[model samples]
Target chain A: MSYNWNWDIFLSPTPSGESTYLGWLLDGLQWTLTLSLGAWIMALVLGIGLGVLRTVPNRLLAGSAAAYVEVFRNVPLLVQLFIWYFVLPELLPTTLGDALKQTDPLAQQFFAALLCLGCFTAARVCEQVRAGIASLPRGQRNAGLALGLTLPQTYRYVLLPMALRLILPPLTSEFLNVFKNSAVASTIGLIELSRQSQQLVDYTAQAYEAFIAVTVLYVLINVLVMFGMRLLERRTRVPGYIGSK
Target chain B: MEEFDWTSIPGALPILADGMLITLEITATAILIGILWGTVLALARLSGNRPLAWLAAAYVNLFRAVPLVMVILWFYLIVPTLLQRWFGVSQSSDIRMISALVAFALFESAYYAEIIRAGVQSVPKGQVDAAFALGMPYHLTMRLVVLPQAFRNMVPLLLTQAIILFQDTSLVYVIGLADFFGAAYKVGDRDGRLVELLLFAGAVYFILCFGASLLVWQLQKKYST
Candidate 1:
């Protein structure tokens, strides 16, 4: 039962001796960053739109927006990713489906993954945004109305900046969630860090080292994000407000 | 667009029911084990002993940082080999399920620890001091006074964590378990009804999570006020 542990496998060059393991990891890291960034941008935009719709005076718009949030927020992201990648394209019109299928399958699937993750994350974000906005005192909105600022103007000028600050910590955590959830895209064959590590493990048969590397990589990214968000929090912190000590 | 097939559900009911059972089992097991393990880790984390706190911290950090899929795959692929080497036993799917449970429990413990620790900390120091003044032992005070209050305060957060745990059980499918998501995929793959099957899967998840949310809302209303 005595097995030789190969520490060298992680450090030493691969048999091909051309591309370092670090290089492959960096490539995967790049894709992970790309996917997260694209998805976060989409989530923020759509989340705000939906959040505002949910809060609007219009009953129909608010009700529909509420339904959208509930549906998306409740469903698992993996299922959504599967549907977007496997099922949605098939349901499209024949010409469009063929075009999507024929166009670089990897790229199309990657885009779909981004969309699904974005839309799903957006539901949570919408909830956070709505809570952020609602936590504001009613007088602020009333004062805005008194000053003759339109509904959008009041939100843009007074409510949003204040709410953004109030919601920064939760929003940061949501961002972390989006980053972790990018892993789901790997199930559909996206070459993100997790998938790349799996490929490496499959080829090299070094499961432990592969997992350790992936774990370290994820920790590094999350720590970096936590630090960045802390700095942002301090900089944007409202002066008079006291956070939970 | 293809016409909606309401009839397909009746035909698919038995298979869907089977899938639903698997889903319920995984979700229930993960919730129970995850919460139990998480509570222990949370208590260890809050213990004044530095070594115990550090151990709990490290556990939480490692699990929370890595993605659940990686954790599940690590267990699925590596645990069997490790177990065979160490224990001289063959691994089975049940073992894999146990491993998945362990991995998820370990991973979720950190989050639950944080939440529970926050709850414990939020309890007024005066309460503990009063318990001490009344000559209650520390452990008794914690159990009788502090934990109950903290847990009561933690109801909503706990339910939210439950919702998260239920969602995460879907990752078990990677180990070849026929949970709801996997079942839907199997049905779709077999029937060539990808869209219909996916929509149905989405509906199933919606029902579970929505139901959990409603239950949590009721608990919050009952407990918070």
Candidate 2:
């Protein structure tokens, strides 16, 4: 049994002649990084808010935060992407829906995918944040309160700074996961790395080479992030903290 | 801008329910196979054999580092050919489900291996020493003393991972198998009621996963003692 192998197809220009196949993939890589980093910013902000709310004394706020985490975390990312892409625009008022529809298609897909991934990863990050806060000594909160700090100020000056540092290791994993999870955006036509590979396979019929290239890129991203986080962890480690080692 | 129609759901439920079964079947089979495979990997990593430990670690690391969707796509493209050459199973028969099952199980085993390894390590070393002191053999000590405690400690984690696996089962749609998510997408596209059908699908997924997570929380509480 024999099969044709073409390692050089990526260098060949596409039928459109605008760019080579490798250019399309690099463009896809650019989008993947952009989307992942974009969504990660959203996840960190929303997750921190929700996580703080979960630890607050107000039952209503905490309950709502918990509910948000439960709903978002339970649904699959692909399903959520579909909802954001196809269903959400229609669900809005006609003026809003029409405005969204009138926007460029790629922009719409990018926004929908970005929001979907942001919200989805936010749920996971919320849990990590909650766990980090909860693992702190109860007296830490009390000390801040006793020191005349308001609740918000306490979280800002006392609880959160320590908690964030404590959770860096888990946060690193979550960051890596966001990059990996960005692949689901391709289902919504976002043209990220996985979709680019699929398109490469379709145009070139080089399934092995396409997928292997995508896999290597993914690994490279993950490894780079892992080492970066390890260095950050080492530099920022608190003496006698949980992950100081 | 169309009127939000709820009636399309009932018409779509039966087909979607069939797809849900396929999703559930794939998830269950994968969880079982993954746990079995993960247990072996966990033991091999702990077995003090350098090559075996390296092999298990490499497998876990490679699978963990890559996205599950890519793994599914790879298996879809490659597994059938390997299956045919090795087992003489013709490619004509429906192999999508089998390929999905194999991919999910293998991909998930990496995660499960880490969880089980942690669980095994959580068991006190003294217990193994005590078992050996009782003249129990290595396999017997592991089977009778270590594994039971380790599994008990890890039940909640295992269940949580299973729920994650259930959600990920939707990725099988890439291979064009009509799992729950695929069925919804197809029915939505066919009838132009994508909004209603997909909303319904998301709700179903939410309920199942939320319910399972609640069960996992309860298990954690129960086992915390």
Q: Write the per-residue lDDT of candidate 2 for residues A1-245, one digit (tens) a residue.
A: 56789999999999999999999999999999999999999999999999999999999999999999999989998899899999999989999899989999989989998999899888888898999899999999999999999999999999999889999988998999888888888888889899999999999988899999999999999889999999999988988865633
lDDT of each: 0.82, 0.91
- Model 1: how far is A102 from its true place, Å? 1.3
Model 1 per-residue lDDT tens digits across residues B1-225: 344454566677777788677777766776676667777788888888999989988888777777889888877776677777888875555776667766776677778877888899889999999999999998899899999999889889988888877777777767777777777777777777767888888888889899989898888888776
**lDDT score at residue B78, model 2, on the 0-100 scale:** 87
On the 0 to 100 scale, the lDDT of residue A34 in model 1 is 90
List candidate 2 segments past 4 Å from native: A242-245, B90-92
Candidate 1 chain B, poorest ten consecutive residues by summed lDDT: B1-10
How do the predictions measure up, each by TM-score? 0.93, 0.97
Clash count list over all predictions: 0, 0
Predictions' DockQ, in order? 0.65, 0.79
User: Chain A TM-score for model 2, please?
Assistant: 0.97
Error of 1 at B16 (Å): 3.6
